[model samples]
Target: MWKKPLKPVTKKAVKTKLILLYEDIVCDGTEGCKRHKLVGKKYFGGLYEGSERNEDLWLEVQQYIYDNYDTEYLKNVYIAGDGAPWSVAGCRVLEKSKFVLDKYHLGKYIYKATTHLDDSQQAAKEFIYGAINERDFDGVMRLLQKCYASTDQEYKKKEVTECARYIKNNWLGIMVRIDDGGAVWGCSAEGHISHVLSARESSRPMGWSKKGVDWISHLRVLTRNEQKIIDLMEYQDKKQRKKNRIECEDQLIQDVQKRKSSRNEEVLRKAIPGLEKKQFSWMRSIINAGGIIA
Candidate 1:
């Protein structure tokens, strides 16, 4: 989805995209092919931006799989998407991978193509799915052509043509279900997009800069993976402080001395009854104990 940028008002909003990858073990309907049982480990990917972003994301995915999963035992990997070229290209990066058409998009096109056939809509859907199962791309086109011819409305004809083209282009993805003997249960990309990315990015009516979107995407993924952002920030802060320990120590000393010499000290002494009597001993104690280093 496109989101408005934070600068250069004249420049158009950039397209923000999120890629998600996961492993699943389908039951083939034997072990009660329920929905929740199919999903395995999931990992959310980052936004693809630069010229080689696609390759970058794929390389990261490959590395992640190798590091976390046992590749030696993996036989086949199914990559399901809405027939986009980028999605189809994933098969080239990962070995033994097959493209499967996400059923959500397939069903959407099917509804558009057959919704005009009122009474025969169900029958037309069944016919289209059967033809897809048989890998008969031409047959599917013929049926769509007939549907187009039967429709008098220009809009209906357009829908049929668009559906036909989508099916023709994604024919292999559609047939993968049959080729894999129904093991490819389908893709839940839309669901994941809604739950993970959209919840923070697009669900509300706010605009986001490209970098802002990228940062939030990583944060969301880290959260999904159960990583604590606070912990990460603390670690980085500690690392930075360690790198500039001498500089930080000098800055802290200067700030403490400045505070000690400030005219506001008398105001604070009067504001609190025990201020002068305590003599800022807490600060001295902290400095002596090395408590301010962190």
Candidate 2:
């Protein structure tokens, strides 16, 4: 589920919206494939205006997977998201999957803690990303402690404390390799949201209705699936044909209900109470000729 942050627009500053983009990628599973060659991807999403209900959000995720992902082939699942409570709920629904604390969020918190350090920020980053602290979360906390002790400012201390608590809570997910067994955790939500969702939906002053936003979100995903463009075009053509057929049927039904004389009568006759025969003929002549008599 690719849910981008709710952005406010001119129409309603307090009302925010989210677009849940459907996304999945297949890679070569062959042992000697050399690289994980991307085979295929499905990208689609719908905009949900206002906050979704708790049950609806989970239901949305289930529907997203059933529609897009092949559960039979989903073996090595690695769920990732920002450290939001709502995000953690996503990991719980999947069985036997590793929940990776998005490195992006981790880095963001780290930056907040170390921003006051200026030059020392790079060192702090290295300390966080280092493989030596693979399972050593205490070591990570100790580094936070070091930052806390060095700072006299309350704001800096608060940042450090927040980061410390975040790390401690998600320490299970903080490892590049859990128990250092060579398996890696991964996430790309921050990158995808920035480049795909935010770039299109939230970068402007435009506001959207439920229908308008949904159509735009779906179109954005469709644009990226170049391989499926032909299929999409063919599908749209079928829809157009169906629409034409339905419209024809409706028009036929309407015609059956109306008398031919009513259809043939000049609507302008009732518009004037006392027009001379000469004026009526002149106007009718112009209507038939499709020209201005004046």
Candidate 3:
């Protein structure tokens, strides 16, 4: 979530807040074995498949949070993902949110878009690439439209039309990054999912139950926040001090796990009810994870 104030803030009170919405596919690399041929040698390996539900789940959670929480803080929210329907669905559902095409995904689109370009179209493709990289979305659209008008091949024209539609639909959100002087090309959600979820999936080949994945993913989010780490450490220290300063290894481990699994807002609400103070300033840092400060 991102927000721009309806009015200018007074000198005494100025704040910038961003909320990052994230979700991941729940798919193990292998789903039942099938035949494969490598170097003329036939062997059986499980089929690798990824879930299409991640985007749906993410949108659902986003709607749930928006329905329940105070989201007026969001000024210029950005929803980014690869070229998955779920990602697109999330963007559609959160129409107010800026829908940014992930840079990597855009590159793939560009590659396909330029495959059959002639010399003139090749130059146009170069122009399009330059505009995209420079965040000149209008320039890109213009170039695309020009190509679409000139292309004779039905398939090529159709590709241009589709790309144009995608660009036009996401134009506003993509343009917002430039107007705000913020980084917009990359996706942090991809990194978050890879680091938190994919790592676990790779390590635990058996695949995770939905609940288990959710629990671990939530724990990973908490652990990644420095303030959460400090709070957990403090909580553990206080608990240890209360228990006659004796460290019971098993109990300590269980307590630490519990802390990691707990929600930050819930924990803070309990620890300092009605305090009206924000404990996790680190959230701001997380939002700027892959962004340039200026």
Ranking by TM-score: 1, 2, 3
lDDT of 2 at 163: 87
Error of 2 at 7 (Å): 3.1
Name the 10 consecutive residues with the lowest summed lDDT in model 2.
14-23
Comparison by lDDT, 1 against 3, better one: 1
C-alpha root-mean-square deviation, each candidate: 14.1, 12.2, 23.1
lDDT of 1 by residue, 1-294 (tens): 112222334555554445556565555555565645335555555667654786676677778778877899987777777887766777788767888888888899989988988999999999988888777888888888888988899999899888988988888777777788644675667676777777887677777777787888778877877789998799889989887998889899999977765545555446756643467787545544444435
lDDT of each: 0.72, 0.62, 0.52
By summed lDDT, the worst window of 10 consecutive residues in model 3 runs over: 40-49
TM-score of each: 0.71, 0.57, 0.39
lDDT by residue (1-294, candidate 2, tens digit) is 345643743454322223233334444577656444223444545553433543355555566666667888866445566555655655665544556666667778888988888888898778866732666666777888888998899989999999888888787766633553423534546565676566876777656666766666656666765546678789999999999999999999878656543544445456765444775776666655545545
Q: Write the per-residue lDDT of candidate 3 for residues 75-168, one digit (tens) a residue.
A: 5445655434444555555645655556665555665566666666567667887786588877888888777777689998888777777666
Give the residue spans of candidate 3 off by over 4 A: 1-101, 118-122, 129-161, 183-186, 202-208, 226-294
lDDT, candidate 3, residue 149? 74
